[model samples]
Target: MSMRVPGGGFDSTNPIRLDFPQSLAVYDDYAAAQKAVDFLSDNVFPVEQLVIVGTDLKRIERITGRLTTGRVALGGVLSGAWLGLLIGLVLSLFTTAEQSSLAIIVGTLLFGAVFGMIFALVGYAMTRGQRDFSSVTSVVATKYEVLVEHKVAAQARELLAGLPGGLPDPFA
Candidate 1:
């Protein structure tokens, strides 16, 4: 049977080394990790053979929510962009320009839109697809975990063992 292990971050001293088996998937966030497990179950991945390691109650709930949402990052970048453009337009009015040209107004709008898009893209890229902002909640921290496909946990452990940081804490 495949095993699931919560991969933990090693402290500064005495770095933990794990031999993670093959067919393993690592998730930085607990919710995303669990979501994958849930999806696999609904899509013919056996639940009985599944193992969830190293997660807390809060992380489990968050991952369960991701499973329900189907991996859509909740926040609306478009809406944010629109609001930013409106604010930019309003602020443009306060600027002291000798003549208000059509080009100037259009340019301001374009600038606002472009900047908004850039900001959105940068933020999105930095997040690496974990920004579920629609619910007004923030990701507190990153959770590392190794999940193996059903019946491959042993192989996964063997593979993980060779990885730089693949050990699970005996205490945790």
Candidate 2:
């Protein structure tokens, strides 16, 4: 999303684009790109005129472990325990002194664990052997490019040049 500034150029609500952006440099990783901006800030350059863009996106799924009935049941029990504890605390707060809050909490905790285990086992059984593993998925960029507004591109480049080993690499 972009909006027209007072000048002929435009500004973006996205906070990442510039008016006629010029590539200040390309980096192999996000940290490097961040470092470039940090360097500019240290030098008192107009840091707000810059943005870092990730390119060449790819999806990655890292397998954590194989799932089993025991692990699933244990996970469910732990989750339910937390929920039951919360409920029991609130219910105990309204009870008379004759009613032992400890007993009420323990009762609810046991019931929750039993129910959670049963539900987790039944759900796992329905899944069958189709999806038996656990994994984490994420989308990441292979490259990061730093951009600067056209009006300040030259100043940004000059400041970046002063950074140790930060000159824009033509071949990069």
lDDT tens digits by residue: candidate 2, 1-172: 5676553344666655566889899999998899999999999877777888999999999999999989989988987787788888888898998999998888888888888888888888999878788899999999999988898889888889988886658695
For candidate 1, lDDT tens digit of each residue in 1-172?
Answer: 3333443322234233223423355556666556655555555533334444553324222333331122232233354556656766776677677655555566656665666556656666676656544343333444545445445566444544544444444345
Lowest summed lDDT window (length 10), candidate 2: 4-13
Runs with alpha carbons beyond 4 Å of true place in candidate 1: 1-98, 137-172
Error of 1 at 29 (Å): 34
Q: How accurate locally, in lDDT, is each candidate?
A: 0.49, 0.84
Clashes of 1: 17
Which regions in candidate 2 have their CA more than 4 angstroms from the true location?
1-13, 168-170
Which candidate comes out best when scored by TM-score?
2
